[model samples]
Target: MNRSAAEKEYEVNYYEIDYNEKLLITGLVNYFGDIATRHFENVGGSLTYSKEKGMAWVLYKWNIDINRYPKYGQKIKVRTNAYSFRKFYGYRTFEAFDEKDNIIARANSIWLLIDTNKRRILRIGEDMYKIFGLTKKDNKPLFIKKVKLPEKFSIEKSFNVRYSDIDTNRHVNNVKYIDWILETIPLDIILKYTIKHINITYEKEALYGEKIKIFTELKKQDEEGYISLHKIVDEKGKELSVIEAIWGIEEK
Candidate 1:
């Protein structure tokens, strides 16, 4: 069934904002992901289906573009839709809007439905696929998925996964991976440049209590923006997630 895109209204919570009183990038991502899950739950893609099928949805990668970051007390609406699937991959898109219906941010993500017990991608079944109104065609993204980072990097800092970082899935939430990456950048870089785009690939789950180091490198830059690469790794140096962030000063 072709369902209307799922939309939910929200107020930028005080706690979810940064020192600048604007919504944090991590917080925006959490809301975006929640909207996608909420869309699934509404259209017969219930938790019961997931459990009974022994399948769990895993995000493969995301490409997010930010136009304006809403500030505290701002009213916003998030819309999400699952569009297509092939093999083991599903495609979805989400958008965030301000009160005037102006777009604030948008993201395109790829996900995989996996057998939870087997820890491998599961060929999507008809019932589950039908619920998402899945098709073979792609929900093509607005921008090219071409963010690139250099091979070289520097060890920036380490963080311990605390209770706060774990989500309902008993793993470090995907948003925390973005947080970990942001934490490694210099304060000046973060303050001076607005994050216009971010590309992240989740490699492995970083469990609670694990200590992870953030390795970073400032990639090449030109008329578009500066690209920065980040790798979140465990104490033994095994990589957990890979991220590339594009930052630039807002145009006058």
Candidate 2:
């Protein structure tokens, strides 16, 4: 591995692996997030910087495609680069590779800068673009389109946001949204299947002690696997996010 400034290495530890002994989707999300945070810190735009500026970076959407699952104790490298930005949105790409240089996963995400005090979107300035060290060579993010859910949900559950879910931004971290969605899934389904693609759109922010409600429904199925739609909301019916995932059953 080149170990360039844009790349960071992480080992798949016991805690990050699931019952199947493979790195889980939530674990991969957390790794990409940590790498992105490192990039911010390297460019003097860390969480502290956002706080001092009375603003914070919020994840708006994400799409991940997994080719192979890295098993426990495998060392993986995460490569991330910020390519473009608009008024309030920034686009970044992430890739995970195994020790043999096999690409295990790829992801695209969109983020927004919001005023923490007023909770409004901030018009990203030219200087802010430079702060991310953008190359301006990347294409527009492909997964920005809205994710539509099924008309009726088959499963709905509620959970209390715990202290651990809060990140440095003082809000329910975006990664937890994936965790909650996975939790709502049945264990039998998880053990029998694997997810190859996931698309999530974050519409609202959840805070500590907030109650989150998750709703899921089977969208469709094929020989390979199935796709499920999920909606995350607060107790008051405010929609927090929507996620659509494509899963395939393990080969016999």
State which candidate has the highest TM-score.
2
lDDT, model 2, position 159: 96
Across residues 90-205, which tens digit of lDDT does each residue of candidate 2 receive? 88889999899988899988999888899889977765666765534533555566788778998988999999999877789998888898887888778888889999998888
Q: What lDDT tens digits, residue by residue, belong to model 1 across residues 1-252? A: 456369999899999998878888888998988888888888877677787878888888898999989999999999887766666777788899999999889888888788877777887677765676654454343332644556777648889999999875667888888877887788877777778998988878788899999989975476555788887789998878788888987643
CA lDDT, every model vs. true structure: 0.80, 0.83
- Among these predictions, the greatest lDDT belongs to 2
The backbone clash count of each candidate, in order, is 0, 0
Q: Each candidate's TM vs. the true structure?
A: 0.89, 0.92
In model 1, what is the error at residue 191, expressed in angstroms? 2.0
Model 2 misplacement above 4 A: 1-5, 135-141, 250-252
Model 1 alpha-carbon drift over 4 Å, by segment? 135-147, 219-225
Residue 221 error for model 1, in Å?
4.4
List pairs with backbone clashes in candidate 1. none
Clashing pairs in 2: none
| Alpha-carbon RMSD, each predicted model | 2.6, 2.6
